[model samples]
Target: MSTRAMLFACWIVTFGMVAATVACAPAPVPVDERRPDPGTVVGSPRRLASYPALYTSTSRAERVEYSSRGPAGEPTVVSGALLVPRGEPPPDGWPIVSYAHAGDGGDPACAPSLSPDLRGALDELLGLVSRGYVVVATDYQRSSARGPHPYLDVASSSANLVDAARAAVASVPGASNRWFAVGVSQGGHAAWAANERATDSELRLLGSVSLAPQLDMTDVATDAARGSLSPERVVLFPTLVDGASSTDPSVVPDNLYRGTLSRRTDAAAPCLGDSGAVGTDDARAVPAADYAPATDEDRVRLTAALDARRLPRSPATAPALVAFGGRDSVTSPERTRAAVRAACARGDRVTVLERPDDDHRVGISPEVLDWITALRSGATPRPTCGPEPTSPTSTGPE
Candidate 1:
């Protein structure tokens, strides 16, 4: 794994929230019964627990625990927030944006649905929604489910996001079919996954915008074993392992935390920063080499799972705009550039946004806002590829 992958796995330190979670054994959820469409809402959307949403004084806010399913065919209830712009619709109704959030590790409280200040962590959503777009973000399954969240379970995260948008269209007044996605960090990965999968769903996804996404899990895991993982990162290992194992049980047939990093893993249950309460000494104590998967079976499973998580698959049907900080410690900018090249090689209509001065929290810049506007207006965004002094297309205000 490159330095960025190590930084990416350890990006949990970037978030400013408390962690709270309990380990859960990987279990088989019932096969997700097929709906008419992958993004179909499971049942009636309940508006009882609505929170103070963006535009509430102007628009409206509501928290709904909607019924949605996973790609595996298991039935589940996912929590999320939906905000509709106040005032009259624009004839055809409001153009919607399915917002995917950054990965906040395993803490359920950090999930936007349960967040006390929903608009703060994701101020970007407020920016877009205030401009007349209906925004919906999912809290993901593991946060509210019986088990640990499968951090990068591509199918589940993608499903959670797509269904949230689908629910918005059904429950929000004047919502249109012209929907797209914008996500950062873990969410950036989900946005990309949704784009790959959305074409087959009932919803019409025009495109997606991803910022500093967690693209290569293999790179991340490799660095962890090298003992290169930071103190903040080591604490997050359990969730990554647990999530991956849940997605592919063969990866860790046995309990991963029953051994050395037990308390550190347990401490990771809550949000970031505080996750260190379990201490950084344990992470420093054992070298990643010592705990390398011993058996051939373990090696095979690890290899396969990593291969599955690499980004830039071929034949993408929609437009994608991806951005990452030039010096991002979390996920490498080089990886983003590589994915851009791979996407181009695969016939994907993609664009690259490189920020020389940014880091893990890639604030949505002005260039990004303009890119979104261009996409909304049907203008093909130009790819600012190639190395050198190209900076984030947009930053802060115009």
Candidate 2:
């Protein structure tokens, strides 16, 4: 089918998921605080026959299933895609990029490779493939793995990202030894975690690029505590709690889900699908005061969980390209700045850029490819260890 027809079909699928609410809550699940063995390897990679709907003609997409630890730290099979361009590789091999998808709802069918592209992800992948780069995209453990999807578990997602990179090397030919990471929103946080976690890994992470990453949890809990969260944001608050509660028993969202809020959550699907979160008319009417943590204990738990999953205060081993949208409403520019400030305080090597006109979805400038190219060529990557820069500097090769 034509691209327009294909997109139309995808749109139909997405709109249907907009206001879907599942009955699931994180506090009652049987699993929580379970830690992975970290060294456990349970399965080998297996390839699927069909590619996703948006798999472009420029590259061949291979759907592969591999094992990864779940949010509650259980091991299970997870699925992903490895796209190898159809041409000769550079002398060493194609440089690898692990692309993490943003929130697509907490459902099995939400895996990027299993459905049509969202947010022009296919176009981005096509650009990388056309440039002879190998793109290894993870469906994350929850979307295709054997458990309820892990919405925001940092440890689990980061581990899967590193594993996904390793899986690329093992499952595809002409995959290079060099690896770089690029993530947006939730994926940006994942990229940050991988940045810290991969310091001791077998696969090398040369650097990372995070676009409008969700940085501070203190801010999140504080916002909720003050009931200042917007209606649109209130919709995602449970997801934040649910993800934390799944892995940390202390993080309970039940206290807040007492009445009408519970009904709103019950009606909304996890991941909110590719259409993103849609606030109900009721949800839109919710005052900020109604969005607070149930008790001091839950508030403290949210604080701890946020602290545990936040970006590294110490410098990551590799260089980083950090970007934020000046006008972003979701992962606000201020939060991104705070994270970058903390990173700078620790003497981490990072380059800050701002898309003054873009929102969260269009953060980091399109020159992210340029950032990657600059890193690969070893011409850029300056440290922001001293006084904090007054503002973001747009980054692209000269």
Candidate 3:
């Protein structure tokens, strides 16, 4: 071949190699389930009880198996426990508080059913029950069962939570229909989503209390890339992104699951245990920025899906009591404010509280206590530093 011809051949070979690499790479997953549509319904709510505890210990915690009509189900079963104070059986059925938890390693093997630690969180659940409130908690659809737990599939997740609350009221002995929702991190995200999507008529949702909710995955991912986030969050972000992207067709499976991303892919399997074990290395190897989508189309679609799957829209219908740690490095307070503002604009009542000294985990209890106090008084809870001055204010008079 002549020199020019040889050069041309080399260029073709290089192009082929690059194309092959691209073709083999995995793309992000898109959501396959229908996004939440808008509508509101009010219906007569009923209550019944069933057994959810297999172990004697769980049985002692006021645990019950409850069901509700949700999405496409005969009845979705959720496990919940009522923690009413020693003597008070809760007058007028007591108010219901539902909790949506953060990612629980997404493995069925390591589900709350199997993990001692998760079961321990039940202590908190039972604590709320003890406070003369019906406490409803869901393992979320995918995480509880050994199936695809759509990590951020807000609609389905919210549906499961709402159904679980309905079940808890009927299943728990002294429970009533007056309800509120609360969650931390992943659970907070679920609570937020459920609040937005819940049918107004189905359940009398008073308000939602969220602690350190992971409202913006993209923002969290960006912070993780900058080394400003925790190691656990860095690891968790990709798993969520991958899980959420799995429903989209434009996202190539291989590209979505390739390289460092694949290391944490197994984290979504719902096997009961520490997901950190499987994803530790991947967490260490990649930076958050590197994990973001490269193309504009990919970014746009991923962001749209994330926004669509978020729970901000529900703030309009119910009052929201949201708290975040000022020192929170995992889920930024600024982003949380943005989400709160969006929800408020939709006509939902919202309150955003910030604890300047708290980190992701420690600052939650105080907020919860404050929320309980506000709800009991029948007054809207106010944000600590006043309204997020940069964001929108609550429509309910300050």
Candidate 4:
């Protein structure tokens, strides 16, 4: 055969083999484009409970269930509460505050909406409502979404907060389009993330306030494993495992914890308070060596899953007020400063409030309240990124 014809025949044979291989390959799964957009409300806010005379400023209290994005970006129902003020709103409408509460464990009943005290933030919520702002607090997807709660997952909490803001404004009379994201501890992380995530929605996020935000869960876990965590902070270990497993199923409880924690029965219960409710009584008093990861692979799996959930995933859409206390060992000041520096480097306008003398309880300070007041009054806040000025100002381990 001619050289050209021989080459052509060889080419045809190679092409046929390639075609056969391609045909035999498994079909790729199609992306589900029909998933509802993040923050899309799935249903009307069902009345869970009400407090008519809870606070003088709040004419009424409405706790309800709404819809938000789950950890996997799927639409799911969640719970929240609204504190509407007594008086008439301004011509524009009453400003909104999307309040993210600190961590309350991974159990469904740990939801703030179910608590009569609003998860110990009643005074704070009442104070906000007194200022003529309608407050909206999310119970997070852990309360209603399928699967384990992604404890520190920023995306899930951000979506929940933004969607709660949307749902609250729609459900409550005289609520304005303008709003601020405010949170403490885990909620603080959510507020910081919502500042970035809210840009996707039509909500006008005036600013964000993150108090002692748990920015680096990987570091927290590392500390816990090294026996360096405080006794008060040790309770967070199970929630971290649950959170990692939720985001990445390969990092399950059995893959990480030992003894009582390896089993789901005890580990699945509420874990935040001093109640002997988390795991077993022995689990609470056990050495870090007992509850820490079983193997290096398990540790690596947990680290990767938690690291992916850290904050400042992107520059925020609006200015942020970051408050941290120097003596706060739970959510250490060093980690918070590092997160602020990273955020500033990424073009986020962050204002820092540092109180060297205080500990983790420095959140909801007078200065932070004043900062919110100034922002509500249309004043542009200057970024506090450089050397933090030594002054007198943080939350939960989350």
Number of the top lDDT candidate: 4
Per-residue alpha-carbon lDDT of candidate 2 for residues 174-264, written as tens digits (9 for 90 to 100):
7876788778788888788778777645677877888777766556777788777755467667666666666676766676444445543
User: Per-residue lDDT for 103-204 in model 1, tens only?
Assistant: 655554445555545534446677777777898878777533345566777778887888888888877779887888878888898889888878644567
- What do the candidate models score in CA lDDT, each in turn? 0.63, 0.63, 0.53, 0.70
Which is the better candidate, 1 or 4, if ranked by TM-score?
Answer: 4
Better of 2 and 3 by lDDT: 2
**Candidate 1 least-lDDT 10 residues:** 1-10
Candidate 1 matches the true fold with a TM-score of 0.78
Clashes of each: 16, 11, 47, 3
**Candidate number with the higher TM-score (1 or 3):** 1
Off by over 4 Å in 3: 1-88, 143-147, 200-202, 220-230, 267-282, 287-297, 382-398
Measured on C-alpha atoms, candidate 4 has an lDDT of: 0.70
lDDT of 2: 0.63
TM-score of candidate 2 on Cα atoms, chains taken together: 0.78
Worst 10 residues of 3 by lDDT: 1-10
- The regions of model 1 sitting more than 4 angstroms off are 1-58, 107-110, 143-146, 200-202, 253-261, 264-268, 273-300, 385-398
TM-score of each: 0.78, 0.78, 0.69, 0.81
Residues 280-336 of candidate 4: C-alpha lDDT, one tens digit per residue: 345456667756677777777878888898877887888799987898766878888
